[model samples]
Target: MRVRQMAAPLGAIVEDLDVRAVDASTAKELNRLFCQHHVLVFPKQQLTPDEQIAFAEHWGELIPFPYGSLPGYPNIIELRNRGKARDVNQHWHSDMTYDPTPPKLTMLYALEAPAIGGETAFANQILAYQELSAGMKKLVGSLVATHSAKDLARLYGQDPDQASEAEHPVVRTHDESGEKALYVCRAFTRQFQDWSRQESKALLDYLYEHCVRPEYQARHQWQAGDLVMWDNRCLLHYAVHDHGEDPRLIHRLQVQGTSPV
Candidate 1:
């Protein structure tokens, strides 16, 4: 298969590969490519729900979306933002970190996109982790942080205190590559468990600020038929809400994963 870099830093487009019939070897190679590239974009590709699930299975088992089931397929998650509806992924996050096994890889197939701006931004958490000061790394490495949907719930007008939260390693080793990554994000990471409220806020604010440095990021401008797959273990993503009157619709399939090993 032919691969072309989208830009200098992060994304790549794989050409001449059939999405429907990816073989085991190809899938393994793709997984390696995904780790190296962080984001893989397939342009002008169309997939049925079954096809999407099947394609996702080439990498690993399909994990259902966090909120609920899709309209037609009870397993798939509809990632759509209607003009009247509230956008779900407005902040930077890794999917479903509150769960025991968060999604390893997330695959999003775009059905619709605005003519103008609705680009997705990805930050390389591995790079973010690697670049931390020696003292900062040691400080964070010694602590475990709580990741929750509570803050996001509050932002969406839901009760923040009622949402689920979990303590995870601040610097987690990726199961596949054994590379360390900063596993914190603004949306889900509530606090460092060992710290007091004031201390937690201060440390978390510092981490969130460091995790999003421009040098570690790449922005993806969606095409209507683009299928984007990303390694959730090593990346944090943000969806830009630039679409005004028009709607943006995406269907996402996540791969089942274990806790960071």
Candidate 2:
């Protein structure tokens, strides 16, 4: 398989490879590419839930998707929508951060896609941290941010307090590469762990804005039979919600991860 960088921030597209039958050496190289590139896009491919799970296992242990899954497979989350105004994926964030151990990687396989605008965007958080002023970096290194499903529930008109919450380092280190990345996001991250909400607002907001700089992003427009996945450890993604009444179906799965240090 040949790997090519997508654009400015960080992403790679792997061409001329069949996803279903990756060999041991190929799997090792793909995993290495995943760490180096962050997002790996394998276009023009078809896969069943079983096939997707089989391919995913080569990278890491599969984790349960909290909401629900495809009928037979407990490891896969089915994303089928005609579009809605109050979309959960509208904001930029990592997945399931409220959990003590959030997902290490997330994969999405497109079965049906919109013809127009329903692009998923990703940001390189490592770049975000590296570009910050030295003082800002030092301050963030000393802090931990609150990430909660409660904040997400509020956005979807649900009982906010009933949702889960956890605290993770504002700057997390990559397990494989030993690189630091800004971890706070607008969707799940609430505020600094020990500070009052009011006191944490300004700083968190600045980080929320800073982390999504255009230079650190890459947009993927979907197509049927496209498989895309990202490293949740060092990147954040936003699912765009502009495609109205268009049928979009994507199968999702994530791998278990340790708590960010």
Candidate 3:
């Protein structure tokens, strides 16, 4: 397997790696590489649902989708568009932050690549946090933010006020690398733990913008047989939906993770 950093801000691509039957030593190296580079892209890894699940298990137990899941694979979800619905994944955010434990990492296997534009962008939150002003860092270091599933529920056609929520520190330390990262996202994060929405809006909006600066981001265009994975602990992703009327399908899996520290 060959690995090299991508042109973007914080991801690397690994070529000639087979995901179907990854060996122990190869898996160990992948883990270390994942810690070093928050996102890893493996082109031409066309894994089936079962094969994808097997590969995902090498890291940890998979996180099941609460609302719906794949027919036979409950832990893996399908993201397919035959051309109708508006793009729901346009924001720069972390996945499932409303859950207490959220997810350790997420992997996406591109099955049907788009003809034009279905590129996904990633932002390095560790770098975002490190670049913050000293006063801002000190201010957020001791604060916690509330993430709600209801905001996401509305987008998926569920009840808007479902009210499932979790509180996590604004500045969270990575479990694997021990680095601090900004964890608040514009999608699910509503307000700081003890602050009202009106009081927290300005700062939260500022952080949401700061975390996704172009300098800290990398973009990946879809490929028919690509497998992309990223650490949810230190990266925020933006899924662009500019490919109208084009078919796009990807199978995604998430691994269960610990609560933020």
Candidate 4:
């Protein structure tokens, strides 16, 4: 299999690799590329729900998204266009960060994509942390932030009072690559631990903006046969909702991860 870099900071387009038939050695090599590049896009592939789940298990244990899952496939969920007002993922975030151990990685297999828009954008948090000033790095290294799923819970018709919430370090060490990454995101992270929202707003907003600078970002335009997987541990992603009423259907899976250090 050949892998080509897709962007400056984080993505790789993998060619000559079929997800439905990855051998042991190829799986190992794919894991290495995943750690190094943080995102992999496989084009012109077809995988059923079962096939996708089997492929995802090569990395680690599969995790069921708390919100919802596809019928007859507990580990896979469907992502489709609701409406512009109901777009829950328009902001940048790591998936399910409010869980004690968020997903290590997420995979999406597109079955339908709009003609004009509906691209997913990613930011390299590892690069974002690396480019911070020394003093800023030191400051963030000592901080922890609270992440909440209240908005998601409400949107999914669940009780907001029981939504998941957890605290994680502002800067977390990637378990596989051992690189530091800025972990705060605009969607879920509420405030630094022990700091009120009023007090944390300034610094948190600054960090939220800093983590997604264009120099550290890449965009992927979706296609019907594209399978895109990304490391949630070291990156933040935004789902662009510019497709309006156009149909976009994707099946998603996630692998369970260790708690961020």
Best by lDDT: 4
- Return the clash pairs for model 1, or none: none
Per-residue lDDT of model 2, residues 84-149, tens digit only: 674668889998988889999999999999998888999999999999999999999999988889
Question: Highest TM-score: which candidate?
Answer: 4
Error of 2 at 47 (Å): 0.6
Q: Residue 52, candidate 4: how far off, in angstroms?
A: 0.4
Ranking by lDDT: 4, 2, 3, 1
lDDT string for model 4 (41-113, tens) is 9998889999888888899999999988999998999998845574469999999999999999999999999
Q: CA lDDT, every prediction?
A: 0.82, 0.89, 0.88, 0.92
Determine which window of 10 residues in candidate 4 has minimal summed lDDT: 80-89
TM-scores, in order shown? 0.93, 0.96, 0.96, 0.98
TM-score of 4: 0.98
Q: Which stretches of candidate 1 lie over 4 Å from their true place?
A: 84-88, 152-162
Deviation of model 1 at 114, angstroms: 1.2
Q: List the residue pairs that clash in candidate 3.
A: none
lDDT of 1 by residue, 1-261 (tens): 799887666778997777787878888898888888888988778788888888888877786654567887765888666563445476788988876689888889999988878889988898899999999999988888888876567655777767777888889998878889999877778778868868988988888888888988899888888899988898999888877667788988888888865
Better of 1 and 3 by lDDT: 3
- Order the numbered candidates by TM-score, best leading: 4, 3, 2, 1
Candidate 4 regions with alpha-carbon error over 4 angstroms: 82-86
